[model samples]
Target: MIESPDGERTEHCGFIQKRGTNNIAELTAAIESLRRIPEGAEVILCSDSQYTLKGLGEWLPGWIRKGWKTASGSPVLNQEHWKLLHQEYLTRKVRLEWVRGHNGHPENETADQLANRGLTLG
Candidate 1:
């Protein structure tokens, strides 16, 4: 889902692959949002998934250092999506914000519903 400064909101839903995870969905959302938002502008990405936020913020440097491997010597799950999200992060001025889900936040609730709707589309 993307929201404009003028209070316009848009939601997009589709499968990233035959198989997907929540992290992939979150990363895809960030990447797609970056594509939608104008360049050189400040953006805040609100997400309920700590996996996505930590993967981009606290874990990226180490992942790059380890050649995309986790601390346990395992390859990072959703490495491709992480790389894409990282690239967008480099190209855009984005701040990842962790929001509590189902906490009465209007946009968050709407996004959750849209995500559920996407699942039913299949």
Candidate 2:
């Protein structure tokens, strides 16, 4: 879900047919949100996944520098998605905000609900 600058909310939840992890879904959400907005638009991208947050804010640069390897020299998981998300993120002015999931954050709660609804889509 994305809340526009004018308080308009847009939902972009859907189920994936293939097996995937929660991190994949989270990354997809962030990636799709950035894809929807125009390049260079200022965006306040909120999420409840710390993996998504830290991976984007902290780990991404080092991972890229190390050819997508982690600190311990293991290959980074979800390389393709990270690459796409990183590319999308770089093309925009995005400020990532991490909201605690299931902590009474209305937007996060709504996203969770939407995600649950998406399960039926499969």
Candidate 3:
């Protein structure tokens, strides 16, 4: 998570489940981070995954109305994480920022390391 002055903080958390890919992992992390934030705080989510950024930022509402199904009528991946994010977003202001992976931004790098370590330990 990235914390700034003025009581602002950015959180990014995820998990690598047995069948989960990196996209799912990143989404999971982002959702986890969102859950820990206090109500009414402004949060900026930085992620390298465009799928995540676009999915949550743009496509989520329609998907939710469709019961988390995709255009092809397939169930959406990572529904639990998506649901959690959706719920938390209802109570806060969240902005998703896309960052290039491995580009050496401090918080992104740190979050990446923590995510990888979480994978190993899990």
Instruction: List per-prediction Cα lDDT, in the order shown.
Output: 0.82, 0.90, 0.77
Question: Which pairs clash in model 1?
Answer: none
**TM-score per candidate, in order?**
0.89, 0.96, 0.81
Q: Residue 106 CA error for candidate 3 (Å)? A: 2.1
**Each model's total of backbone clashes:** 0, 0, 2
Alpha-carbon lDDT of model 1: 0.82
lDDT for model 2: 0.90
**Candidate 3 residue 62 C-alpha distance from true site, Å:** 1.6
Q: Between 1 and 2, whose TM-score is larger?
A: 2
Candidate 2 lDDT over 1-122, as tens digits, reads 88788898888788877898999998888888899999999988888999998999999999999999999999999999999999999999988888989999999999999989988899
Q: After TM-score superposition, what is the CA distance of residue 119 in candidate 2 from its true location, in Å?
A: 1.0
Q: Against the true structure, whose TM-score is highest? A: 2
Writing each residue's lDDT as its tens digit, candidate 3 over 1-122 gives: 75765757554444464788776777777777777778788888778888888987898988988888988889998788778777887787888899998999777788878877677765
**Ten contiguous residues minimizing lDDT sum, candidate 3:** 8-17
